[model samples]
Target: MSEQRVRGVPAQPSAPDGPTPKRLPAGGQRGGPPWMGAGMPAERSLNFGPTARRLLRRLRPQRLHLGAVIGLAVVSVGLTVIGPKVLGYATDLIFTGVIGQQLPSGTSADDAVAAARAAGNHNFADMLARMDVVPGAGIDFPALGRVLLLALGLYLAASLLMWWQGWLLTGVVQRTVFQLRAEVEEKLNRLPLPYFDRQPRGELLSRVTNDIDNISQSLQQTLSQLLTSLLTVVGVLGMMFWISPLLAVVALVAVPLSVVVTGQIAKRSQRKFIAQWTHTGELNAQIEEAFTGHDLIKVFGRRREVEAAFHAKNEQLFQASFGAQFISGIIMPAMLFIGNLSYVAIAVVGGLRVASGAMSLGDVQAFIQYSRQFTQPLTQVASMANLLQSGVASAERVFAVLDADEQIPDPAAPVRFTDPHGRVEFERVSFRYDPDKPLIEELSLVAEPGHTVAIVGPTGAGKTTLVNLIMRFYELDAGRITLDGVDITELRRDDLRGRIGMVLQDTWLFGGTIRDNIAYGRPDATEEEILAAARATFVDRFVRSLPDGYDTVIDEEGSNVSAGEKQLITIARAFLAEPALLILDEATSSVDTRTEVLLQRAMAALRSERTSFVIAHRLSTIRDADLILMMEHGRIVEQGTHEQLLAAHGPYHRLYQSQFHQAAGGDDPMPVAAASTAG
Candidate 1:
């Protein structure tokens, strides 16, 4: 039989979800029309300037492509801005042709203009003197056609180049975003387990998924447009000044006004944009928890409570999104109003200059068009401030993840484990989840090759922490742990973990066939070896009963199978790995008594000629173990054979008596004095 390919993806993620961020007590997001942009749903100090700079740096690799895109934009804007002035020439041609045709055919230019002045058409005479037209000319169709065709060619070329620029920019921006995602994925893997402990999976996923996606979209939509608009402003400003300096200065008055207005709104709305995306992440976390814990929520009949929480988060998100959009939305209209005021002033001044013959009528016409063109780009820039703010906010969140503290790196020259012995030891190992509250302190122990060490402890007694330290999931705060007398830190993490196999208390299975999941432990396992592992762990019986047998599909959450079935599959996986050292933290607690006995026999065979550590509350399973260690409050209180510990009547004895007595249908609660002493 061919082996099925299994994905490395983990199960549908959601264990104990973290709490939502605290909601603001009052002020920012109730839509009270606080024009100063006061009340915020939630707020944090975002490094806006630095984050935007970092985002720009992501485009550095595409500098050549960016240069080409910018060059295209400049050429396109130049041609587009020149169109109005060229069309104004056509307007002058028609006006001068009509005026000259109304005069006598044999008249000279000086006599015609003198006649107009004598007839009290002084402005008309001044305009005629300014124009260059033949005395006998009517309309010159060929000349007019040439000017129109020239205008058409300029605009057509500009449009084509603009299209090319947009296409090139799309490729450049997408490539940059692709690189950013790869970096983010690599960063997630390098972060330590404790970092994950501090972050909720859903929130982390949001930064990786939603926030990065927002950044990509923001760049794609605005980058090209912003470049074009700014370039257009420069092109139009030059044209306006060349036409008439007076009207150009009149148009320049609106720039500072627009800048001041936009800056005020932007400064206030940026924090709101940050709050908006934060609310989105928090809301996403709540939804993920509610989805994964749907069964638990229903079983506990806390449906109303969950709904109420969802409603509150949903409302917070709505308020924040609305505030960010509405406050920033004001920029477009405010800018348009300022530009209009400048437009009216320029129009009034240009007309006076044209009537005084200081400017030609065609120049005044082109100047009006230039003023509109100049103000338009500013309006466009103001309109995009919200999107820019939103994207920067998301980028800041993603940057935070990338900048987090990574795990202590592997040694430069790692020690090789050519052939691992089963021996393991803790040399005065001290560690804690928190510095102020020590959990494990100066604890030392040893396990000889081919020995079984059964750890018996109540909840919160550091049983799991001990095993985790063995795996190097969390670094020790002090002291050292070793395998075969060499410090574990000296060995590469993968090399050390490769020699150890673990079956954690929480079972996880990816989306794959049963065969694939079992083969995940050793992808090259033979068919016979896989069947042997399945039979040994009691998974064979249930798997054969399924319609697809070993090929039966397991959902991402493994929800189609029973909990015991999932546990059996994971055990079979560990068995197939065939590592030198084994750690089982309540590996068989899910199976029934009938199945437990069979697993114990299989485990014993597997434990033979190898080292193993078993953690269990069921005392009967570890009775024949070579050594037994009882832990309390992060310290091992006793270690000996099971019989020896029972004779000693220590905490292990009290725990064993309570369990055995219960099995025999009798109450054997520890005495008050004994419990106090144990504490």
Candidate 2:
């Protein structure tokens, strides 16, 4: 595909019911205001040489196009100056020689009388008195025509050149934007998960979608405007100096003043812009949260509460945006006021020069026009200062994400896992979500290859944390997790992840067909493989019962499918992956008893040749597990076969008894297990 094409376009034409990957968090999104501007001034001290160079390199492909556009700008700017020069010359001719010429229309006496009055020499009545006042000398029709034609041609050429520049500049900007967007997306995929944990998804979304968009828009506007403004400024100043250096000097006093004023405004507004963007992100986050939890809000009759929360965030966004724009808006009127003052000064000075004959009337007129043209660019430059600053801020934001160094990089030399036999071992691994709060302390476990290892625990027991470690989602604070005696960190993340499959309680289905959903884990799988995988998970029966069978589209997050069907499709996807390690985290929680039995059979088939980690609310699902690790407050309190634990009549036994009796409609508390395994 061309660079203009959006990236991540699928390679195959599949049934459109596939599941998409979860939206990864953006870097700047973590724990901050949503509407923050690009880069902090403090961050500029850090090296961005690489990012600048990279941006320049990306623009290199469009260098030829940019060069052509700039060449056109040069021609256009030349005409912009020359067009007024032509008019000035014509004006000079009219003042010095044209009025006394014979009238082209019917030679009326009144016309001759008016010419005589304009000349103040009665030359029209006494033709021989002044030889320079003859009709051809005064009129010069052919010369006039040539001057008009030349101006017209220059005007047309300049217009055409401007058009071409505008057209080509768009191509350059859009292509660069497309490439940058694709690269940013790819980088997000490669970035370590911990980077996401700290940032908010809404903030990241604003950066990627809003900030990057701002950068792209700013780049286009700045490139075109900066080039044209610079060229026009230079050309007009050159003409002004050519006409009268004194006037040129007077007009330019405002240039430096304008710059100073613009800089002051920029300095003041930068923080505000940052704050505006941060608040916008916060507002977006709140809106997303409220919308996503709309059902909960309605069920709880908290619509008014949600609206109040929304209004609070909206007001914050409004204040920030208004403040930022108000500061930026100060530039235009200030520039125009300065420009008007410069115009008045130039006119007063030039009028004196014209009266004294130090300069011709035409020369004074051209100087006035040129002075205005020169300051026009200055005014534009001042106005666009805001856009440039915004761009830089946006660049800083985008680069902040690109420059984040807090990710867990794989070892320099990654180990190859040719045939992954998933024997996971956590050797004395102690972990904390935060250093001040210990979540799992001195945790160690060994799960043999091709065995179902069940972990039973209440909320916050760190069962999920164990699976996360196995997947290397979060690095251990102090411990090593090895797979078949090799450190998992040494393995390439993609290679390591490819060997594992997971089915979460929150099943995510994208806008695609059931067939596509089933083949999501194996993109290149055949239709037959998709159908077989679905049948294994008992998803095919439901899919086939649908109006269009597997061909039916599951748009809007598979809203058309039942929750149980969504779970079944997720199971089918995992089955298709056929990984060496499978994790089922409350996988069957949404399914009914009949569906649960079918899901168990699917799990049995998937786990036959793979090590499985199961976190189930229903203890019966894991009763036959090879090892049941009973966890409490981040430590494994009991570990053994279900029967052995039951026979031991300790922590696991009492807990199982309470749950087992509860299933039989009894209410009771069980004996507590020791806090830690050693205890």
Candidate 3:
């Protein structure tokens, strides 16, 4: 498939027929109207087991901290479980005091207890014996005060432990996220160029920024909470069984039912959560595309179309999100209802037991409290299922990036050049982005040291792909590319690329001072060297004109500067690198005619002692080239000097006649010549 050239840089090649732009269907995929589909990519299914395992593996580095956090959570939950029982003890003390005051004035304690047992009030009698009762005397105020104080202390300690656990967990979560983000950034750098070509930048950014943030928040808020919930359930259940096994059995019945309900709801809701984020990523992609191409959209009068597209995506996102939240939302209330039913049943049965002296009032109260505690955690855990699902989905996205295949790895024992002179050669090289379609086949060329090799080709003739191969950005499907007689694949990528400098058609500059941007390739460059490179690129005139000169900070993508100025700064960066080989892919396309002349003069000087490959549409720019390789269909159709090609009257001859000749005010003898040659 032929690739389209954007100004000067060739677009990545696609299928011969090209990918059909996905159109909004007349009736959408689901049989709705044209606007219903939102054109979103299909959502990927979640494989929870593997993804969860991979995510947990990332926490290996923080295992010690995580273990400590779990320990603290256990301690905090233990105190929480003990605190309620202690409060029940205080209640028993108050009940005993009140009952002692109500005893008949003349009745002896032993006789009263015996009469209570005879009436099947054995539990009441047991309580009477435990109380320090004096006939017609009030309750023991000191003992009740002590019990209340103990309950108060237990609660206070539980609160303190919870606060401390949260504090420790926050640091652990932040650090883990920081490490995760760092690894993702590193992985991006290592990934092959093809990986990027297949995905949108905004979607990848969503994974790195948004997905990671979700995982971080879940860890911070939900991880400890989940652990505490489990611990509370275990501790509360133990206390319940200790108080009364029969009551514990009744409470346990709700456990399986809650699990069944939660599982059924979560099984459906998880997919929706995955779809929600998928749609969210699509929405982000749309916004990123619109903002980046705002000028194009305005110029084309596509505002209505853009808005309609965004609306469709927004609606889809809303549907997915609402479905996920609504389904998951049933868990908390469902668990609550089930929990309350169990509580009511336990209350009725326990009340009967207390009346028949089968259980004490305080014991029943404690059992009821334990039942609440038991169900409370179950409800909490059911609620957390949603967060866990969302987190797992986010984690799956993040891990997908981390697991992406990296660029063809560097050799086990890489070679390097010492004092290298750039003499590149392609030996029977064959490459194709897709194996089904071969682009460059048996392509062979030699670029001698310190010579300017100008590659002239129609779009999709593999001009940019050739340079990409030289830079080792894409590996050859067959054969080898060598630099100064050393096979490039055997050389360390850093070492090979260190000696090669590229100034692409699209200039990129980070947010930094002009000097910093210029010194990007060589961070340790001196002020003198920076100024020299800037002067060579004719950027010094503009730099000196600015109030801050070299210190002027450029906005992101150098938006603060004009396009032409950004290109000059990038050229200055390349010059500062002082590489042995230089690839100028339409480097001067953005500059004005006058600036182009100055740049040509500077390039001429730089090209004299360094190997350079120039790709440009302007034939006049390469008139002085040492060798010009005319390419067609990824083959070298012609080769030699500018005069040699023009005299040959071949493809390059026609291109010059139609483009350069017309630009120079010559009569347009063949207006269709360029297109014919391109075909």
Candidate 4:
């Protein structure tokens, strides 16, 4: 296949035989095509403590609702804790009834009670006080029924409260995530252009969408479980001690050991989780690039290369994810083992205590249940550690964007333009994209109202940089720019940019009707004004051919239309805006020759009585410009009218001859210069 052309540039040269595969970079692989692996430095090494603190700080706005959720969780857990103990009481009552039934005929109730007391069973003695028992009666069925009913009610109430807690927490999580998403979007707008230039679009997108979603999921699922587990641990420990201090001490032995084991495993898992998510983001970036650049990849026969890169990242993600999960996966079983050990200790010790008549069977049963409950929460907390770690990792990435440096701020007190006349002046301006590498230095120029100035240069000659400085997209390191004799820096950015209209080599038209796209700079444009602007830019010619005319919808980036057609629409938009100043940067470069002719005509009409700055690669387009600045390196090499520059035989003269004279198959340059001057 013939070489495929990329936008605004010539086709890329074919690769050499046996092309070397691209490798992902070190230090988490900082830059590549979005999908190959663009690592965000901030997410590489996470400080769990600080990230957690900041995440909590973000919850300050929702603290009131969070507090309420906590309260409900506590109430629910408390009710749940009480249910088992009440059931244990019912068991003791049944045992007592069986014993009463087994007593010999004519045995007195007081004699049986004395015999139970003689066995050193205080709980049995207390049960007798609460119940009216005949020596031969089997049981107090009514009392046991009531106790069982109360336990059932408590369990039901706990379930209801848990549901309510989940409901409230859902709202809190959603609202918090909503606010976080909003902040990320706002941060994107505030970040400097350089930040976006350095970061992949897909990486930033992952932070906003994927990372934030992880955090939301963690809060929704794990947070409530954490609260319940903590409360359960505390309540169970208290109940254990109430049953028998000896068994409670035995159960306490497992708490510190479980904590130590979980902590060690969690620390290792945290790093793995960070890597896992980082790799996920890298993979996301790769997918975005692959899809967006699908045509490029296919045209270049890079399917194997693309798949190889993807496979490499996919493997890395798999390994990291598996490591994290496998390490965290150890927590549940390990905690459960320790919990079982505690349970056995309690059972053995309690059995002996009951045999010695120091503890009732009912109390031993309750103590064993409490021991199981205590260990159950420990296991839950251990399981949640992985989720908490992953969430913290995601939160770290989200916060990194929020903490990025913003664009240069506006002045403390901004000035406003009044009755602007579009007289622009650049005075001794010096600027650089990086301080070490200067692009434009000590440059000065003045553009009077309603005049056309053409800036021409080879690539990297600061032609576009001049326009960027004029637009205040980047602030100058030194000197200043003025619009209509007022310092532009002092004016509000909106006020300064509002008066200028720009149409670039790359035209931008959002998904909208042709009319809407044309009226983008002037949304309030009337139908007649829109039609007139379209006609002026020759955009109506094609719009009329369309089935829906001006109302036809275009796809995003205006892909539904031809490139030339998109350019004409953008030109029409500038025409409708009717700004005091206009900037056309290689505006005719992408169109075909015929379209270029029509565009040049339309542009001539638009330039009438308007201050215009035209940056062009085709020297023929700006032959009639009133003032031409020929640039090389970072400064203007020559400045003159077209005929005068040709007469002078300077840098502009040499450039014109090399382009036009060679293209015309003429070696002699003087005659062409003479003919141009005569014309």
Which is the winner by TM-score between candidate 1 and candidate 4? Answer: 1
TM-score of each: 0.91, 0.85, 0.91, 0.89
Report lDDT (CA) for all predictions: 0.80, 0.73, 0.79, 0.79
The C-alpha stretches of model 1 lying farther than 4 A from their native spots are 1-43, 665-679
Q: What is the lDDT of candidate 2?
A: 0.73
The sequence of per-residue lDDT tens digits that candidate 3 reaches over residues 597-656 is 999999988776789998766677889999999887778889999999999999888788
Task: Estimate, for each residue in 1-679, the C-alpha lDDT of model 2 and write its tens digit.
Answer: 2211111111111111111113234443433332232232232332334544555577887899989989989999899789888877666666545544544545544555566667775433343232223333365667667877888898888888898999999999899989888877877765655565545567678778988898788888888888998999889888888888899889988888888888788678777666666666666666666677788999999999778877876776777678778898898889899899999999999987765546766777888888878878877877776676666666667777886654577789999988888899989998776566677888889999999999886666788778877777667888899998899989876677777788877777778888877777788888888888888889888887899999899985567988998888888888888888888887888888888987888788889978999976677788889899988877899999989998989877766655556545534344333223211
The regions of model 2 sitting more than 4 angstroms off are: 1-61, 99-137, 663-679
lDDT of 4 by residue, 1-679 (tens): 1011111111111111111223222223344356424333333578899998888788788899999998998899999998878988887788768866876548786776677789987666655544445667787899999999999999999999999999988999899999999888877766644455446667778889999999999888788888899899888888887888888899999989999999999989988899888888878878887887898999999999989988988888898999999999999999999999888888999887866657766788888888888899889889988898999999988887787766777789987766888888989998776556666788899998888999986666777778767766666889899998889888766667678788877677678799878877687889999999999888998899999999999998576899989888878888888888888887776678897888788888888887899987778899989899998777888998999999999988887875677547756543343222211
Question: What TM-score does candidate 2 reach?
Answer: 0.85
Poorest 10 consecutive residues by lDDT, candidate 4: 1-10
**Model with the higher TM-score, candidate 3 or 4:** 3
Clashing pairs in 1: 27-39, 28-39, 28-40
Clashes of each: 3, 18, 0, 3
